[model samples]
Target: MLSRLSPRTWLLAAAVCAVLAAGTSLVYGGARVQPASWPQARPEPIALGRPPALPWPSHGQAAVAVAGQAGTLRVYGKQRPVPIASVTKVMTALVILRDHPPGGPSIRVDRQAAIESGNRDESTVAITEGQSFTERQLLELMLIPSGNNAARLLARWDAGSEEAFVGRMNTTAAKLGMKNTTYTGASGYEPTTVSTAVDQLKLARQAMKDPVLRDIVATARTTIPGVKGEIVNSNKLLALPGVVGLKTGTSTPAGGALLWAAHPTSGDRDRLILGVVLRQGEPGDALEDRKKAAFVASRRLIVAAQRSGWAKTR
Candidate 1:
């Protein structure tokens, strides 16, 4: 049969034989191959450092003020020039109260004041032009609601022009030992409004000493009639335990910052500790982080005071 096969058949048969041989070799080669082995070792465990003794404020720049009956201590960062947002009103309110005092004549909001007030921003106390409100109401509007209009109105009332009033702000800050602080506007909307965490601490401490300022800041809610409607206090931290009162600030550039004062219900207290954080995160988150940082620092200070016999137990 092999001799009877044609050349074509022979070629086909040879091809089939070759394919069969390749398949057999492949099968044997695959079976003969063995997996490689590796050396085994135990995984190392990671060691985390000790947690911070005190929780630090999460914001970029944070200032905390804790007041008691005793002395005060303030820790802050590089006294740099950064926008303060609505916190500029702190100085405005102080200057206004100093000039007008509490229960003084009412402030009339005019066109210029309203025009210079609010802008496209996250927070504002809308006050229309031609609105009339008491000096006390204006103070509340400035501090409680952080009304930009209120700040501008008070500034205009004080110095005749917002630019001149900012000059006054710088002058006042200098007098108060806030060497690093500077003001370009009453509402801190301008990026030129700058102060350090340390300088803000100084300002907060001074503001806290004023009975009227303290009372106004501690207030959780207030009503102030405006040209269009009534304004109300918006600082939610007033309701928090141990919170006295201070101020909250926010801006796109400055981030969310706060000057907070807190104290235990009873004690030979400590003076306020002021903390300021610049260029933090979102407004809400930054405020919360600053509060937490203030709480932690205050608690630590309280404990230290007790241990060092600085604060007497009730």
Candidate 2:
């Protein structure tokens, strides 16, 4: 029978046997034959690190996210978004700066801006109507004093109206991956304006990158061209060593909050841990008491991250 078969038949049978052998080897758990030159993959290196825990607020809610070379080390809280008050200005400032990269354009403070400052109970630099300020000066007044009016003027001038500016604020927040945040106005005066500490950290990191904003926030105090009485940053924490500028927020519903950026753990000036502490105490606390609560809570977070291996030594 083998001799009767043609050469083509023999070749076909040989091919079928080879295929069957390969299939059987595959099904029967035979070792796969790798190429002689096949390269082996090395295991990824693991850093010996532990997640950070808390000494967080016992009264009001607070959340923190610590970032190192490996990315966000960990986060704490209900992780729920809450009212963020004037910390809202950080978004206001970021949107304006992004739209106007050449920031020296002049802004004519309108009567409404002055009225908003004087009539409302929020922070302000009291920019007067018809008073012209260079963009940088405006930024100085707004960021340093935690000025609600300055934020309004900037939003209106940059986007042609306050509503439009706020629209831009929400849009910018969305782009920053702050899905849990919302901005209803230029200043975070309204209780409806809110965010989580985790969301705010994203905004904080992006905001710190702008040289103009970076310079403005890091300043403990400075005199603007037209403003009387030296413009001091409301963030007294700036006076603390390694403490730098970001912003602070307060309101009846929001309690006291702060967004902070600085090198607390590692002495490296270039590496900074961005921290967000929101609603640090009962809503009805006195203004100074609320502020203290926020400050103390944030400081504890920084200390926790630093000692718990989130911070690298300088």
Candidate 3:
């Protein structure tokens, strides 16, 4: 009977048989298979144009860029690498976190770190020798107060020596495409440790990505258990409307340097703005005065960025 069937009938019967066989296999397997889901396409990022004019600082190299975006909107002054002062701590924090995360092991304050704390010429947190602090607390001491001693302690704890840690800083900078950056010391005390505003902005973006570092930078003030008083953030820009966490650097050669982050709302989107201002004020200016200049320049640039529609939403 099968052999005598018409060709069309035979084809239809074969198709039916195939379907029945598939169903039978599924039944035996005790499950019915559903088609795999196709991934939904992601929305394209919004493209933004640089404004015709921004309040670029007259005396320094500065650049403003959106986080996750390549390149910057506008840059001012010479792009050559210049001393970045304590802004070098951003990389120090970043490298330390990369090795030992926020909740990692506690570190003891060595004699050198404790001795360095008494140096009035550089920023320091009063932590005694043999006193132990968690990685997170050390970061707060280093970043919030801009403590040179705390930064070096973190470097030594992480890499056994400041030299080795600085090597890692430069390696990480190179990996992040900060081509003009160089790290000669864990603390930005050495005038030889240098970078451009654009390069520091790149570091700012990376630094803000770590949740611990992000929180530490945004904190206005905090007190450690053994510390004498509250440690206040050095980045005065944090008081600004949209300004958040970042680092500040000031020295004779570095002048005043700031790697800053802000989240300003444009339309319905909260945009992350990362900026770097370097070499604000004359090298001969006092450290506090120079740092104030960086803060002023940063504030102007941030406000201008919003007014000029630099932070756009799709």
TM-score of 2: 0.80
Residue pairs clashing in model 2 are none
Task: List the candidate 3 regions with Cα displacement exceeding 4 Å.
Answer: 1-52, 70-72
lDDT per residue, candidate 1, 1-314, as tens digits? 77999999999878756755454332243574222333336655542211123334443554443433233343445556778777778888887777777776666789866665566554556676777788777778778877776777788887888888888788889998998788888887787788887787778778888888888888887565443455455555556555666777766666665666665444444434344455556555555564354444444543342334323332
Across residues 50-157, which tens digit of lDDT does each residue of candidate 3 receive?
553668887879988877655545688889989999999999999998998666667999999999989998888888999999889999999998999999999999
What's each prediction's TM-score? 0.68, 0.80, 0.82
lDDT per residue as tens, model 2, 1-314: 68999999999888756765554322224665322332336765655334467677665555454444555544556767788889998898898889887546588889988787686577877667789988888887888888888888888888888899988999988998999998998888888898988888888878988898888899998887777888888887787667777898877788889888766444344567788788877756887788888899888776776566655431
Residue 155 lDDT in model 1? 83
lDDT to native, each model: 0.65, 0.78, 0.84
Q: Which stretches of candidate 1 lie over 4 Å from their true place?
A: 1-53, 63-77, 114-119, 226-230, 269-273, 282-314
- Clash totals in order: 19, 0, 0
